[model samples]
Target: MKNVVSYLFLLFILGACSSTKEKTGTSQAEAIEQQTIRKIDVHAHYRYARPYLSSFFQDWIMQAVLVDVAKEDSTGINRSWKQYVDMDIENPGVFYLCSSLVGVGIDDPDFATKNIERLKNEIATGAKMVKVWKNFGMVTKDGSGQFIQIDDARLQPVWDFLKENGIPVMAHIGEPVQAWRPLDNPMNPHYEYYKNNPQYHAFAHPEIPSYETIIAARDRWIAANPDLPILCAHMGSMSHNVDMVAERLDKYPNMMVEPAARFGDLASQNSDKVKAFFVKYQDRIMFGTDFGNYDPAVDWTAEQLDAEQKDLDATYNDLWRYLSTTDSLVIRKQHTRGLGLPREVLEKVYFQNASNFLGLE
Candidate 1:
């Protein structure tokens, strides 16, 4: 059984109503219908991180069975994802995955190839999207024990395989700037992992590449893999710069983005640029929550879990404000956060893009 809070959060996410709703010259129900679940959450994780041993979050490979949102059937995967987490389930769908072979000591080309084989078996079984987590930029290393990047040569074979299979990879690179800042949001409750894992807080070179440099590396990785339909997870992992993100989308036809767990500090700061990015490249962007059980670090301590909830609620509130509000403000470019977008655009972000990218229906 999952923890009480886990199930509770799931119920709230799926059951909680947005504080506001509107009809921009049409039926709201119709709008919801159009935007509903042709989508699959290409970036979600089915299992918890390494912290909680008995909790659902710790069941890395097959814990979806334990959630109210998870199902015995493949389609159940879609329903469970939304129903359990409180997303707009009207159009919940996507074959979510935790696609990272880099951390598995994938420095050897042979092992890399073999790992790809392992991944292929999973993909064969039903994995649609691949998730390259934040570890690459922060934790993962290579041969001779050095840090490997998102585009390390050793992992080329795996990249090639995904491209060949038409499986889109949701690559989440670079920690949020605050995640690195010792005093800022690192202590933010959602970041239970940082407390236990000292490695996350410690960086080899804080100022070496700079934030933009890491983004450049991320872009380079995408540019190098042209055939692979790649979704730059977390708004290309650069929520601070929407103009730059828009440029990336405009430049790369093969590329796309997901607005997962972002809309908070970003909307508060760059509302204008952010709005422009969403309105302009609306089709290229997908909606995501980055919601998963990152409870391992707090598994042994209830205090840590309590802290995480507060942070999560704050983040969720931001999403609600940004995505649901109809107010028109000018952060810089005169745009809106939750345009209550057209059904088509909503469908694109929530489902279609994921489907086309992953070759799912």
Candidate 2:
């Protein structure tokens, strides 16, 4: 009887030891997943046929030039995103999808009412945020043929709905400062684009609107609707000058800037100053690639798709290195070094700030 009792006691001890080991292993896995979750790209353009998507996407298109799929089909985009998410669900942080709204009939009297209902439906369907593009200030016009500034009173209902629902608006209000500069200027990152798409060049059409005018309209909107959250894309459209962007950040408490496709703009500045700017306002900036997937106008072969995936991997790594290291890199033809930000600051820029701002976490 004594021998039997001793053996049972030994078994109990061994069982406890095994359970502790398993718990430790699970915790280590969770920590590693958290690191991946720390990085989030707040801005990118993705097209899908579906109007509604869930709050979290498996693959968040770190960057795509363009993606063209059917207007009614969400399968392609959903599958791509799911594959990305499946990579490491335990980590629980990768990308949050923000869906866009089509401006099919802004001139109609029912536009706002219909869109408001649509926006509510989208939010119910899992959209985390809303995006309003440059068309508002650049191409869209009022009934009188005057360009519709972002602050146009006609859109008050939409703004009110967003404000009431606490849905942040990711607004790209105007073209980059380069759009107003001479097309021949080599310093302009958009030189090639403007050269090929001259219709968007502000230099060619003096009657359209001035940079200051557009900016003024955007600022006025922010001021008028102080409670509404705004995510200003492309460094608030002043990437050419960080000081100006900083000034606006200081002025607008409800605004945050996402640096997308403007790495060159920051790279051209003094690295120390730029790094300091990031560190100071870490909570107010987001890392975005502005990667888009547009329809290439032809059926993409498997090889073409593979090449694009390769390009995406390289681009994502490039931005990561720039933000998290001090190594020098040639970004957009400019030789610049990385910011080597601390882990805390990286946490904020990569994901924490976004989560807090969007109320996802």
Candidate 3:
């Protein structure tokens, strides 16, 4: 009976959010409109499965023009994000976070420059967005082995190009807090990669900037280009600090955030706080299920799902079950579980906020 009631309620909400032009402009209608969930999934990778995708298929993209709908379907990875563009027009559902690539870090900025030229020439053809991944911190290096953070002057042209094209860039800068070290702390989880792949751990002069420094650089980049709107990934690199994230969002009119993979922990810890954060900043939040990238061969089999679920399940468990529980679990990607978010706020966090940010109808 409880399950049935919940199902009915969910259906009701889905129905209310489905309509576009309202018939009667009643208060209920207005509330429904405001509450309606539209989503622009500002994250998800596209790859050329024709060649290089079988590897990163479990976790990233490989580069491709288009993917056959049937060939490499990732709906299991993102059940809510099907028909990437159709989601925007049909319902207040998940829209596409279309992104473009420019260069191969500082190593090939010349190539990146020419590549971007090609991109510019073809921007009108369907490149609706730009998503610069953590390539800067991971890729840029000088002869002295100095790393080029996102705000590096050489990359200014990259930012300028996006601004000129009128496409907002979702720049995911900085490695997560624990990507640099391997010690088990209350803040992070255990990962086997750091134990073996010493390179993944920042051993030498970390081309990858520190968490604080990277956020600073990212914020500075955003601040300098007031006109170039950037939806900073993982909460402006302050996913670790909700208060500061709120502060930054308040400060940057041109800035926004997407809850890519932090949903479970934050919602589990303080559901009410997460709810309040969303209600207060509903206009600024965008929904992003950090799925895609399924290299089944490299990642794991059913055996690894338990560990993986700690991270992936947080988005759902936190989004839905958070209304009731505050108990923490081992959340994914090395984050300590538990961030208790509210029900209504979860709805906004799930999709509505995303829709508004992307201007999806």
Candidate 4:
């Protein structure tokens, strides 16, 4: 009787476990049917100096599941190139890298050949795109001390190589338009940033190309490379004016824009207008956070890093909330309602567009 009772008890336990597994499986299937996971941040900055760890930013990588890491040119920052490559290698499905190359040798007679070979190596080793920074028109100067704009003829070959090889270019061509305005200007979203980083303050420099000039050069390059895909990062630096961005989107079919570090600009706009812009150009937009572990200017402590990480996550959630619901919310001291984007539009802006742009689909 004791043996029989023990056997019955084991059977009952097994039956209960089986029943729970069946219920869980059914619930999972129902959840999958209701919503599919589709999210990608196409313009993240994961590259850092040698002593790199993902202590704070790891949740983003895991939650977003797919992040495109843009390896910005270290030029004066002393970033570790190997760190980016290693991260991509170690986190195969999680990270896609867009490597950067400086313009130190645009005037070099062998600039085209040397850089083309180097670009080929980067591509061969899993680079999906190449990044070009604002140094061309902002700070870099020719032998005559004249700023070499993006349309400089000497850099044609580099563009041609990227075009011929079908590699995309990620262009961070200019500072925000507010960077050119007076620091005291209240409307300038970047007022605080420029005030803190005077080196990047266009008002302080005075000699750098005007905001219009920088934008013109960038547009000229877009026209020149009609076949190559270009990602105009930070909403092509026209986040303050969605109409201007819309005009460019209508003009350049080969170009796409990513909203990285420009959420404040979007949130400040009329929510209805912002929703319309996203709806109209859902296919041309990609989501990006510009989140990274290092900023050479700041001597970051672990505590600071933790705080930044939490803030970044919170801001990202706010962005999602803005798109996913119609609730009114305050962002950056402004009262604005949510865009209430549809699920299809959200899928494209969040994931599909990135997959198509990055060739990851």
Candidate 5:
């Protein structure tokens, strides 16, 4: 009886050891998978720097480019620009800059020249790329009250300079096609935005340029600068359909795209189809979260900071899972299946492609 009891005790101890080993092995595997590849967010607008921000990037093995835009309200432009530049300086390899030209003087004869000088100065100060915002096609107007389209003849000099210097442009020229449709479907990723910002709701504002007009002008600008490299921010504003994006990608070999702030739209589509799209354009698609506005002056409590970190972790993890796994997941309150993309595709989409485009390789 004593011998049998001792043997039972030994079996229990061995079982416990096996379970512990299994758990540890699983954790180590997960850590290895998560940290194996480096990532770059090609589009972001981090206006201010915070002390805790570095940890987020380090934890994810990621870097980002802080994009600057010349908005109509210039009250905080200088301050914000300095903040971004300082952030890039502070975080040497972790942060980069993408500068933009002033849009307020598009009608002036010297607009292109002045912007060229500004861009040169910005490039000297460590700008890796230039950004042309939607203001060119949507907001900025000429002396005669006509909107200044992106393909305007006056801006040819600026494009020429970029092309000559081998600098890429990040063009965010138009709103999503859903902007032209009514806000009847809450499921649309852009429904809330158009509902809140009625000025940009093209269906309501027929006076503004139609969606087709803006997209055509953007295409013309792109085609005219065949030698120039252009990264279409926000899936070329064609997030509504992967087919449309593919068509553009096929048409313009000099162009690439980053799906900033449009992950929900991708998630809304059939997962298999989207996965195929990524596979087909694996070399051209890059990752961008559009995450920004890390101002520490808000006096956030420890609890708030903790909650914010949790949210950030979840966001990154969700995106990674969607791209790298085949698990069923809920994204933005919608049920969707993961892409289960191959490791090679993920590597290119997450880092390799962006590195090549930004010349960080």
Candidate 6:
């Protein structure tokens, strides 16, 4: 009886040890998998450096490009530019800078010269790319008060300079096609934006150039500057239809695009078609969330930071699910199926392509 009791005790001890080993092995495997899932957000606007933000990037094994827009307010633009530069310095390998030249004085005779100097200075300070915002075509006006289109002759020198310097341009020249349509459709991803900012709502302002006109100008610019690498931010503002985007991609070898804020538009489309699009143009597309406005200057409370982190976590998970699985999911309130992209394609889209574009290791 004593021998049998000792035998039972030995078996219990062995079983417990095996269970511990299995749990530990499972945990190590999970950690390794997470370490391998690296990503790069090619378009973002994180203007301020926060410890939590850095922690979030490290937690996800992700990197980002802090893009600046040359808006009407030079003071705000300068502040944001300085903040982005500081953020890049403070968070090496995690944050990259995409600098923009001021579009406020395009009509000035020394516009190109002055802006080129500014860009040169920014590049010396670690700017990897330049952003040309919608103000180039829609908001900026000339000496005669005529809206300046993107392909304006006066902008050629700047484009030439970027091309010569081997700096890629992140061009956001127009709004989505929905910006020209009525805001009655809640399904449209841009409905809320057009509703809130009526100044950019082309539907009400017929005098504004049409969508077709702006897109044509952009196409012309791309064609003219064949050597310049262009990352068309926000699906080149043609997010409503992947087919339109593909047409341009097929035509322009130097042009690439990031989905950014257009994931909702893609989600609204047929899943099979979207998946096919990704596979076909796997080398040309990149992942970008258009996530922004993380200003450290704002005295955010602990609750606000926590809420923001939670929201970011949810958004990243949703985006990952949409890209990497076939499970049915609701994105931006629209029920849709995931693309179920192959892992290799995901790697290129999520990391490699952007890294190659920005010349990062």
Instruction: Estimate, for each residue in 1-361, the C-alpha lDDT of model 4 and write its tens digit.
Output: 9999999999999997677445333244423422463667777666543232343334433322222332224454333456677776665566676777666656679977998998898788777888777776787777777887888888888889888888888888888888887788655567677778787788788998899999999999999889989988899989888999999999999989988878778888988899999999999998887766556526778787666655665566666666766666766556678787888888888888878877876
Candidate 3 residue-wise lDDT, 1-361, digit = tens = 9999999999988876554123212235333433343323456543211122233222221111111121112332112223333323432212243634522335654855875785575455344566665555665455557666677777777677877767777767765555665456534432454555455455433555676776787888888889887877767656655787899888888988876665543543454566577678867776664654344335455555444544443343333333223444444443332344455665566556544554444
Query: How well is each residue in 1-361 modelled by candidate 2, as lDDT tens digits?
Result: 9988999999999897677435333244333433454556777554432111222233432211111111212332122332222322322333355545434356889989988996787577455777776766776666678887888777888889889998888878788888887887776677777888887798888877999999999999988888999889888889888899899889999999988888888888888999999998998998777774555426667676656665764576677667776777867777888888887887788777777878875
- How many collisions per candidate? 13, 13, 29, 0, 0, 0
Tell me the lDDT of model 2 at 241.
86
Task: State the RMSD for candidate 1.
Answer: 11.0
For candidate 5, write residues 6-112 as lDDT tens digits: 99999999997677545333244444776988899888877765666788889889999998877775463332567789888877678888988645676778888
**What tens-digit string does per-residue lDDT give for candidate 6 at 228-300?**
9999999999887899999999999999999998888899899999999999999999999889765564788
TM-score of each: 0.64, 0.76, 0.61, 0.80, 0.88, 0.88
Better of 5 and 6 by lDDT: 6
> What lDDT does the true structure give each of the candidates?
0.55, 0.70, 0.53, 0.74, 0.84, 0.85
The best-first sequence of candidates by lDDT reads: 6, 5, 4, 2, 1, 3
Best candidate per lDDT, number? 6
lDDT of 1 at 220: 88
* Stretches of model 2 off by over 4 angstroms after superposition: 1-37, 48-95, 101-107, 295-303
Residue 284: error of model 5 in Å? 0.5
Q: Report the C-alpha lDDT of model 1 over 33-128, residue by residue, as the tens digit.
A: 533334344444433333232232221111121111211222322223233233212112312333444454565557776778867775654556
- The TM-score, computed over Cα atoms with residue i paired to residue i, of candidate 4 is 0.80
Candidate 6 lDDT at 328 equals: 80
Model 4 residue runs over 4 Å out of place are: 1-35, 48-80, 185-187, 295-309
